[model samples]
Target: MSTLYLLHKPYRMLSQFTDKQGRATLADVITVPDVYAAGRLDYDSEGLLLLSDDGELIHRISHPRHKQPKTYWVQVEGDISEAALKSLRQGITLKDGPTQPAKARQIAPPASAPRQPPIDPKRHPSTSWLELTISEGRNRQVRRMTAHVGFPTLRLIRTAIGPWQLDGLAPGEWRTETLHAPRPTDKHPNRRKAPRKDQRARPAAKHRKP
Candidate 1:
């Protein structure tokens, strides 16, 4: 059986479990043995991060080819123009290549906890909130894409990944969920295979920081 954990990652913390430089990381908060992050979130970004001891689940969640949707609540430095919003929805070209079309729209600010060190309005332009969802996972893709459309992202917080959501977990807090078997997806061609008894879920220990 695998243990799945949802972590509400805080801003400025590394996605990795360890850091030789001694910056905060999963190890600093989570004591779970053998669990690993399913994807990478930038140190500057915050929000939902999934962890699992099952390698297969990890692959399904992290692989861009699987096309799992990732949703973010972004605060950008400007009153985003309709043109920019349209550009984001239509897919903008980046240094890497043309990104896949994304679901994006202006939104009211989310009710999230105040960041430890608040974002400085002086250094940033007047900002607006946006809900952006992408099916591809790329290095700093949200930040890069927003910048490309002339509305630089001042803060990025992922709200959900695939079928899972943050579900109100506070910063540095974590909760566990169980997956009885791998849910069938387009990537799984052999859907007829029976799930192994060992693949069942179990209650996982909670890990949170004060």
Candidate 2:
């Protein structure tokens, strides 16, 4: 039995327990010990971040190799056009690399409360909003990809990660639930296998071996 928490991390909150400058962290919001964040949302970003006591679950959720899809609502620094939307879906090249093709589309303004310090008002003329879903989690990837297409992200909120969603969680709030671990026979079990003992001990038996 593992303890799983769906936390809505507020803006300016650190993902980890400790900060050199004594900033806010999961410790301030969640009292549970030995629980670690599965993936990270930047301090300036908001939304669902999974926390758990099970190390294997953490690895499964956070590691890119697992291919968990994350969905985000991003407010960018310009009105998004169909051309921009197409570019995003096709994949955009960033300084790091070409982002994996993403599912992107225009979306109605989100229903969340207004940001405390609202996004820059001066940029309102240029800003627009979109929803993007990507299976890969790279450092600041969403912001970078949007910027690469000439729309710098003004605000970012992750709305979903795989099967979990932000749902009713409010900013700075957290809820714990029992997450059933996928069994060996479950769909998409980690499939890499170790080599057999004989296979490891013996050299290549092929006729073309050097």
Candidate 3:
């Protein structure tokens, strides 16, 4: 059995258990014995964060090879244009390299709890909401992608990861569930089976009266 913790990581909190600078961290909200965060939300980003004692779960969520989809509701400065949305759908070229194409669409404001320190409206007098889903987890990839597309992200909130969602969770809150088995789509990694030998029974040679 695996122990998994679903946390609504508040903005400005580190995804780690502890921070030397005494800044906010997962330790402040969750008190489980040995669970660690799966992947991570940036220090300034907020929304669903998955934590677990299971290493396989952590790898599936964080490893880019799996191409697990992570979706975010991003608030960006200025009105997002169809062209910009199209670029995001195509892919962005960052300093590192070209990113995998993403699922990008403009969206109405999502209903959710406000950040502890809300993004200043004055700073972003004109803003638009967007739902972006990406499979690669480059560092600050969402922010970079949106910026490259001409709309600087003002506030970012992850809404879902693969089969998991931020639903029913609030900032600084957490819940636990014991997974008896992986979710259907998240079943164990596949491995080819070795070929089986013939299973047919041959008729015994009639008792040759030797």
Measured against the true structure, the TM-scores of the candidates, in listed sequence, are: 0.87, 0.84, 0.85
- Cα lDDT of candidate 2 equals 0.76
- Report the C-alpha lDDT of model 2 over 1-210, residue by residue, as the tens digit: 666788898888878776669787766676665567877889899999987666666666776676888999999886888888899899888777888889999998888756768876775766778999999878889988888888888899999998888996789787777866541122444533332221111222332210
Worst 10 residues of 1 by lDDT: 192-201
**What C-alpha RMSD separates each model from the true structure?**
5.6, 13.1, 15.9
Better of 2 and 3 by TM-score: 3
Please list the residue runs of candidate 2 whose C-alpha ends up more than 4 Å from where it truly belongs after superposition.
183-210
Model 2 TM-score, all chains together: 0.84
Comparing 1 with 2 on TM-score, the higher-scoring candidate is 1
Q: Give the distance in Å from residue 83's predicted Cα in candidate 2 to where it truly belongs.
A: 0.7
Clash totals for all candidate models: 0, 2, 0
Where model 3 places Cα greater than 4 Å from the true spot, the runs are 183-210
C-alpha lDDT of all candidate models, in order: 0.81, 0.76, 0.78
Lowest lDDT sum, 10 consecutive residues, model 3, at 192-201
lDDT of 3 by residue, 1-210 (tens): 776777889999888766669998776676665567767799999999887666676655666666779999999999999999999999879999999899999999889897767778787789999999998888999999999988998899998988888886889887776778764334455422221111111223341110
For candidate 1, the TM-score is: 0.87
